[model samples]
Target: MAKIVVLGAGLGGVIAAFEIRKSVRPEDDVTVINENAFYQFVPSNPWVLVGWRDREDIIVDLIKPMKKRHIELVVGKAERVEPDQKRVRLTDGREIGYDYLVIATGPELAFNEIEGLGPKGFTQSVCHIDHAVQAHTAFEAFCQDPGPVIVGAVQGASCFGPAYETLMIIETELRRRRIRDRVPMTYVTSEPYIGHLGLDGVGDTKSLLESELRERHIKWITNARVIRAAPGMMTVEELAEDGSVKQLHELPMKFSMMLPAFRGVDAVRDIEGLSNPRGFILTDKHQRNPKFPEIFGIGVCIAIPPIGKTPVPVGVPKTGFMIESMVTATAENLGQILRGEAPSHEATWNAICLADFGDKGVAFVAQPQIPPRNVNWSGSGGWVHTAKVGFEKYFIGKVKAGKSETFYENAVLGLIKTKKIKAH
Candidate 1:
């Protein structure tokens, strides 16, 4: 039996592990390693920040469920990946060897790249539950005072949806708290426009997002390159459409939440020839690390160039379905490897995004996550928000129950193409 080690227990990692277990024989040893035993529902983080949801509501301990799946769970931070040795070194001084490795360590919060911007300094981030907890605390304190609020994603940063979601949720929370009049809100972003969203404005995203912001009376500044951030101010350089830097503007705020640029988690960061300059794992269409055939990466951990650039530059979005598609492809490849067959990687864009706007939300579905898709569609309503919540609930339950087949079927459903299945 081949020993397999899966790093991280995030959405991608957990899904990959479950699907892999389902495909491989029962006697094969499959192990999952992560710093935390619980799996966090990242999409629900904004709600948690606004007091709409508690920390406990979004956190799930993986030990009980993983044990039921007969998967070994190692709860500790992975310190190093000695790929040449085919082993992973843990913080507790344990080494786990594997015939194959799945790198799903996810992204690292590089707030330090911006001067005076981080969890300890000027702003708050909803990237993690702990950060959101701190943000909620700071937000409550800010509410008592009532002042200007600045929220946006930093330059060279992808994952723009969360930033937009947080801004709207905060605005909604303030209105619900009866403090809307006390807060002057501004939505500043690295994107050239309101709806670039890393995919160069999906479907009607540009018009839809802009209309929502205008309706909410929220001021906006786009194509902003944040140079510095402090307790009361942020300095940014506006960019011209030709990719030239424009004048720098210093803006002040009572509370700020800026999404930092994302990089690959540490395990692959310093590895030679494995990751790019930005610290994202360089993978082929199959999500396999180009230099290391036996190693694969999924989700935000892998490197994908921007579809296009605006004034501030837009990065790619790795929505749940997209990541699951990568995971599904990886699992299938691993199954082939276990059978002594050559493996091939093939991933096509199939994305579904639900962007919540407080009381209501927008739902988008695109076949090729980039531009010029086959199934390009979008809708807006309160029911979409309800659907998002319902999907989250159903997803978490299914994951915890280790229902891999059900999850895979639900993920691809009608999207998987039979023609795409070709042997290597």
Candidate 2:
């Protein structure tokens, strides 16, 4: 019997385990390894920072669900990956052998790359639930003494949506509290433009976001590099098209949230031929590692180059829908291999994102997440905000129910003509 091991219990890993179990033979052993036994809905983190959600609202216990599926659950941090031996070594000195391995450890927040950044430093973060909780505590203190607010993504950061959403959500909250006028909000981003989002401004997103910020009286500095952050202050260097620093600003703030750059986790970083320079798993189009075919990578752990060159580094985002497609493709291909057939399936890598701003929001659909695609559409309204809330409830329920892909979910994707897995 083949033993399939899925690492990390984030969105991708959890869904992958369920999907793989559905596709693999019953005799095959399926196991999921995670540092914690609970799954946190990462997308709701921004809401948590603004006091819209609590810890219990987004955290899901995986013990009962995994047990129902008969999937082995190991709670421990991964220390090393031995691809040659087809085994993963846990931090506690235990090894789990696997016929196939799926790495979904997600990105390691590179906060140390910048001086005085991250929760341990001066700035706050909403990347994780714990960070969001910390940020919320800081926000409470900030509200008592309102000052300038700085929010955006640092250089080399790929996930820009959360940064944008957090900024707007904070604005919405402050306005609701009648304290927005006291807080001078400033958006500093590594993106070349306001809405580049590393995909180069999907469907006039530049115009839509620019107008929205302007309407809300939010100022912005694009092509920005955050050199350092200090208590109640941050230093930003705005870059020109020629890659030179056009100007530097010492912005003062009582609250700040800057998304940090991402790299592969420590367990896989030093593994040669398995990861890129940043430690992200290097996979072919089929989500299979070129050097180690038995290994697959999905979500933020996979290496995806920047969409195009910019004045500052901006990595591409691996959105929820795109990662879901990868999970489907990986399951299909692995199932084919088990059935004595050639593995042949590819994920569409389509991106369907909902970026809520508390009251109103933006929704975008890219047929292919990368630029130069077939369909690139973006729209904004209160409906998006409602839809986002509904989506959160639906997704969390699905995870609780141990259902990876539902007929309604598949039917919706089918209606959009975007198959989860397609022929390569």
* Top-scoring candidate (TM-score): 2
Candidate 2 versus the native: TM-score? 0.96
- Error of model 2, residue 96, in angstroms: 0.9
Q: In model 2, what is the error at residue 223, expressed in angstroms?
A: 0.5
**Tens-digit lDDT track of model 1 for 276-386:** 887788888777887888898888888888885466656787888788888888998888888888777577757778778679987666777877777666657786677
Question: Candidate 1 vs. truth: CA RMSD?
Answer: 3.9
Pairs that collide, model 1: 286-345
Model 2 stretches with alpha carbons more than 4 Å out: 406-424
Model 2 CA lDDT for position 26:
91
lDDT of each: 0.83, 0.91
Q: Candidate 2, residues 1-424: lDDT per residue as tens digits? A: 8999999999899999999999999999999999999999999999999899999999999999998998899999999999999999999999999999999999999999999999999999998999999999999989999999999999999999999899999999999999999999999999999889988978778998999899999999999999999988999999999999999999998999999999999999978899998999999988999999999999999998888799999999998888999899999888998889988899888887788999998877777888777778777889778878988898899899888874334533643564322322
